[model samples]
Target: MSETITVSGVVATPPELRRSSAGVPITSFRLAAGQRRYDRATNTWVDNGTNWYRVSAFRALAQNGIASLRKGDRVLVSGKLKVRDWDNGVKSGTDVDIEADAMGHDLRWGTSRFARPEAPASPRSNVEDAWAPEDDAAGGEVTDAAPEAAGPSADPGRDAWAVPGDPILADGEPASSPEEPTQADVPF
Candidate 1:
């Protein structure tokens, strides 16, 4: 029997996606969850030991999980948990695994942006494909040529990221060689 549980942890391993013998998609990875305690004596947080869980997802979940999950990413997983005893010829141990029902990045730990994936040959893809160069009969490598600049930049040779009104010439060369700013030069 399996128990439903929610686990928040860092993905300890890169997710691996594969096809089953029956052609079902499967994605699996290892998760590491650790406990942290506030140590008043030291005025700091201390990490306890970590628990490891093997996570697996199937079907569409497997495909998306493989695409989104990477090692060291903090994730929240809700699923059925299984504990089984295993005894190899040389050793005996217990395995903890989670068959994920739903999983995603843990927002509390960091920020994430969500974008729905679309099928190929999209309008944006068509525009991108136009920039790609075709391979020749001798060279079988396909690569994208440098994209054309939209138009002539107002100052082509100038660093586009230069400070608003510091020192630049019409030809886009620096008016003077840059020097480290002393504390006095700071407005603040």
Candidate 2:
């Protein structure tokens, strides 16, 4: 049977990163989800239950998780349910895990912003300098290129340029000048 599950919980620990035999990056962590309840007689607050699930994230997701996540941070995880059974010298039982497809911080807790890091002024090696070239194709070293004239130029008078057999205007009609406008030209 196919099932879909989503859990929002606090991270119980920092992600543990490791590589598979194939060298794929994987990170494993535990998530703890809990809710509050009230006793009918005493009317005292109590934890209903805490569900702890092992979560695994792969590749880029794993890297992001390791960098951005911390213990006690709340996150939302969505993915398929996985159950594993293991038998060793000590003990064995089926453990529930989540093969997380998407995991991210619940931003309602806080907000953050990122700024781009400035490029290093001087590269250490020739190889690094060669890989990231400083010059344009014309071989001139580029400090900056003029932005406005960077694209193909168009004639000021023409409404639209015509390709060989394809004419811009239909039935040989004269092209509409820029100054002319109709009801459609009015902005809402």
Candidate 3:
């Protein structure tokens, strides 16, 4: 039986999206999770060795992973975990891969905005088709164009939460342009 596991780590490589011969969309990435600790002998913070994992996502998760995550971003991934042994012509080693069910940016690292995709009209339509990229040419390799940024607004002053500059009201509207919301304006 596959074990479900959750892990948080920094993205070590850009997510690469590809399609299987059967046309299933898949995305994979390398993650580096370092263990940090205070060394009593050193009297300072130190990083224990880092563990690496290969993360794999299928279907819509594959598409979203490419669009939402990048190298150096901190993310939390939860899914079925598998370990496999591999041997090249020269050497061999065991590798760990997680078939992700859910993945997202770790909020402890920073904030994130969410936008849901529109539902398909017909259930019969293939979801993978929507996630798959068009081929540049028949039998040619797929282009690796970077997906547009969807993390934060271009304007630094805008956040939906109750920040000093942009304060969202009870009704979910921004404060008036005349003035920023004062301490009294927020309900608490």
CA lDDT of each prediction against the hidden true structure: 0.78, 0.70, 0.76
Better of 1 and 3 by TM-score: 3
Task: Give the top-scoring candidate (lDDT).
Answer: 1
- TM accuracy, model 3: 0.65
Model 2, backbone clash pairs (residues 3+ apart or across chains), number: 0
**RMSD list, candidates in order:** 12.7, 13.6, 11.3
Q: How many steric overlaps does candidate 1 have?
A: 0
Candidate 1 is scored at a TM of 0.61
Candidate 1: list runs displaced more than 4 Å: 119-188
lDDT (10s digit) by residue, model 2, range 70-154: 8998899998888778888799877779989998888678753322223446655654344432333444343222222322453
Q: How accurate is candidate 1 locally (lDDT)?
A: 0.78
lDDT per residue for candidate 1 within 55-126, as digits (tens), equals 999977898899999999999999999999999889999999999999999989987655445444536545
| Backbone clashes (count) for model 3 | 0
**What's the lDDT of the predicted structure labeled candidate 2?**
0.70
Clashing pairs in 3: none
